[model samples]
Target: MPSVEILSRIQFAFTIAFHYIYPPLSIGLGLCLVIMEGMYLRTGIKMYEDITRFWIKIFALIFGIGVATGIVMEFEFGTNWAVYSRYVGDIFGSALAAEGIFAFALESGFLGILLFGWNRVSKGVHFFSTIMVAMGSIFSALWIVIANSWQQTPTGYIIEGEGLEARAIITDFWEMVFNPSSVDRFSHVIIGSFLAGSFLVMSVAAWYIVKKRFVEPAKAMFKVGLCVATVAALAQLFTGHRSAHYVSEYQPAKLAAMEGHYDSSAVAAMYIVGWVDAKSGKTTGIKIPGGLSFLTHGSFNAPVTGLNAFPGTERPSAVNFVFQTYHIMISIGMFLIALTLTACFLLWKKKLFSQKWLMTIFIWAVLLPQIANQAGWYAAEVGRQPWVVYGLLRTSDALSKEVKAEQVVFSLVLFSLVYTLLLVLFLYLLNKKIVHGPEMTPNEEDDSDEFSKRNIKQLQA
Candidate 1:
C-alpha cells in the first residue's frame, strides 16, 4: 500500500485537476460575455444581446461548479496537509481575506444583476454588471496566483519555528503579494483562461455554422472568439518566454528539468521533441543546438545551470515527464497561433464560414486550449515536486500526522464518485443548452433572416 503522504497527494491532485476545468471556463466566459454585452450596448443589436444572454447561462453554470469544486481544496488543506496549512496559514490568511473582499465580493455582488436583472435593470446597469463580474473574475485569479507564486518563490516571510512547529510569518504584505513569480505566472494563467473561454465560443459557433443552425449568431460569436484567441495566443508567446527567464533565474533545477538538461558545464540544447533517459543522464532528439542557452541568456554560448549542479535529491526526479508536458504546452500554443491566423486570413477574404474544413476543425479545436492549459499547469506544479513550498517545506513532511493511508483511500474513492457524477450532469446540461441554441423574438428572427439573406452568397461561395 502507498504511504499516507502518497495517497493524500494523489487525492489532492485528482480533486484539483477536476476542479481546475471550471475556473478557466468561468474566467474566459466572463471576458467573452463582457465583450458581447458591450457590443450590444454599443450597437443596439438584439442578436448580440441574445448571444450574451445564452452565454451568461453557461457562464453561471461554470461559475457554480467552479465554486463548488474549489471549496474541496480548502478542506483538503486542513484534512490532508494540516502541517502545511499551519505553516502557510498566516501568509494565506491575508491573501484569502483580500480575495473575499476585493474579488469574490465584487464578483458575487454584481453576479445577481448580471444573471436576473435583465428586465429589472436598465441596459446600462446590466452592462456595468457584466463588466464588474469580468473584473471580479480577473481579480480572483490575481490573489490566487499571488498565493501560489509565493509558494514557488517564497519571500517577504521568515521562518518562525523549528521542525514540525515551524511556520512562515509574513514580513511585508505587499512583498509577499508581488513575489518574483506572481506577475508572470498570473498573466500566463489569465491569458490561458481567456484562450480556453474564447475557444469554447468558437467551437460552439463553428458547430452551429456547420449545421446551418443559428449561423448568423454563430458567425458573430466565432468572429469574437477568433479575435480574442489570436491576441491571446500571440501574447502567450511573450509571457511564456518571460516566465521561462524567471524560472531560469530563480528555479534553475526546474528549468533544467523542463529542458532535459543534465550536464553542468555543457551548453543546454533545447529539444523540439525528445526523450530523456534519466538513468543515462542524456536527452536525445532533434534540437536547436544551444537553443536553451540562447533563449535564456540571449546568446548561443551562454551557460544555463543544469540538473547536474543540483543534488540528485533536489532535482525533479521525473525529468522526462516535465520535458514532455512543457513541450506539449509550447506545441499547442504554436498550433493555436497558426490556426487563428489562418482563420483570420480566410475571414478577411470572406471565406471563413463557407470553408467546411476550417469550420469542422474549429468545431473540435476547443479541446486544444484546455489541453494546453492543463499541460502547462501540470508541468509547473510537478516540476516543483519534492518541495511543497519550494525550499521551505518538503511535501513528505507536510502531511497530517493523524491521517492514515486507508482513510485517504476511502476519501479518494468517494471524491472520484461524486466528481464523476458532477461531470456527467455538467455535460448533459451543456449539451442541452448548445442544442437549444440562442433564443430570438419575432422581430429578431426577421432581422436574422434578412441578415442571413445578405450573407447567403458568402455561404454559397
Candidate 2:
C-alpha cells in the first residue's frame, strides 16, 4: 500500500533540511556581529571595524537565502500539510504573525544600517543597530519555538469538532509561549546556533592561518570564536539535559523509543552506540548500563517507561537509532567545546600557531557541530512519530487529502535539484570571497611589505 505519510515525511524533510542550512548561520552570525561591533566600540580597534564589514557582506548573502528558504517552509505547511495547518492553525498563525511583526521587521530595518550605514551613522548608532539585529534573531526564534513546542507539549489549545473536521484554537497566548517544553528547546536551539557561529569563526580563522594571511584579524576572530564556542557548548549540555528531562516527563514514549527500551524498568540502559532490532525490540552492539535512567531521571534506578508499554501505533520504529544518533551529536558537540577551549589555551601559551595539526583539526571541526545540529533536529522531530500535533493529531491524518503522491514527488525532485545548484553556487562564491580576503589598509600593506623582506632574509640565513 502506497502511503501519503511517506510522501508527507519526504517533502517535509526536504524542505526542512534545505531551510535549516541557513538559520543557524544567521542566528550565530547575528551574535558575532554584536560581539565584533562591541569590540570596536570598546577598544577603538580599526581592525575589528574592518572585519565586521567583511563578515557583514557574507552575512547579508546568507541572511537573504535564509529568508527566502524559510518562506517556502511556511507555505509548505499550508500546501503539503494542509490538514496539519488547519488542526493547529490558530495556535501557529499567531506565533508566526508575531514573528513577522516583531522580529522580521526589526531585523530588516536595522540590518541595512548595520551593513551599509557605517559611514552614514554614528558609532553609537551602529552599535545599537548590531544589538537590534541580534535581538531580532532571538525574537524570531522565540515565536518559532513557541509554535514547535506546542507540538511537543500542547497547551492553551482546545480541540473542537470530531475526526477530520477537528481544529485547535488558541485559548491562551502566554501559556503557549511558556509551554513546559518551549524554554528548554528554545534555549538549546539558540545555544546550538551560537555553537555553529563560533565554529564558523574558528574555521575561517584556521583557513587564514593556513594561508598565512590576515594574522591579527584572524587571531581576533579566533578569540571571539573560542569564547562563543566554549560558552555555547557548555550551555548546550545543560540545556539539552533539561530538554531531555522535559521530554521524559511530557513525552515518555519518545524517551523510551530513543533509548530502545521495550519493557518498563526501574533502570534502563542507554546505548552509547548500537543498532536496534525492531522485530526483537532490543538494541545490539553496545550499551551503557543505567545511563538512560541517569540522563532522564538523574538517578541510576529511576523507573522509565518502555516501548512495549505503548500501543503498536504509538511507538516510533526507529527509537534506538534516533537515540543513538542524538547521543552521538551531543558527544561531537562536547568535543568541539573541548577542542575550541584547548585551542584558546594553546593560543594563550603562544603555541596554537605552531601546531599545524590542531589548526587543521579546527579548520574541519565546524562540520561536526553542523552535522550534530541537523541530527539533533531530526531526533527531536522524528522521535515524536505517529503524531504531528502530539496526542491531538496523527501525521497520517494531517497530510493534505487532495494532494497526490506523484505531484509531491515531482516537486520534491525539482526542489532537490534546484537547491543543490544553489548550494554549489553559494560555496563557490564564498570560497572566492575568502580567497580574495578583505581590502587591505594602506598601513597594513606597508607593514606586510616590511614583514615579507624580513621573512626573506631569515629564509636566506
lDDT winner: 1
The sequence of per-residue lDDT tens digits that candidate 1 reaches over residues 1-461 is 99998899889989998988998988988889989988878777677888999999999999999999999999999999999999999999989999999999999999999999999999999999999999999999899989999989999998998999999999999999999999999999999999999999999999999998887889989988988999999999999999998899889999999999998867889988999999999999989999999999999999989999989888788899999999999999999999999999999999989999999999898999888988898899889987889988988999999999999999999999999999999999999999998886445455434454433444334
Candidate 1 residue 250 C-alpha distance from true site, Å: 0.5
Instruction: Show the lowest summed lDDT stretch of 10 residues, model 2.
Output: 449-458
- In candidate 2, stretches whose alpha carbon ends up further than 4 angstroms from where it belongs are 447-461
Over 1-461, each residue of candidate 2 has an lDDT whose tens digit, in order, gives 35667976877787787778778888898888889878878876566787788888878888887887777787778778888888888998899999999999999999999888988999999899988988998899889988999999998878997877789988888998899999999999899988887788888988888778887677778778888888888788899889989999999888887777778555788776677788888777578788888888778887788888888899686776677777778779778778867877887798987787887898998787778888888888889988888887888898888988888888888888878887887888778877777665455435552224432343234
Whole-model lDDT for model 1 versus the true structure? 0.91
Question: What's the CA error at residue 280 for candidate 2, in Å?
Answer: 0.9
Cα distance off (Å), candidate 2, residue 307: 0.8
Candidate number achieving the greatest TM-score relative to the actual structure: 1
lDDT values for all models? 0.91, 0.82
Question: Any residue pairs clashing in model 2, and if so which?
Answer: none
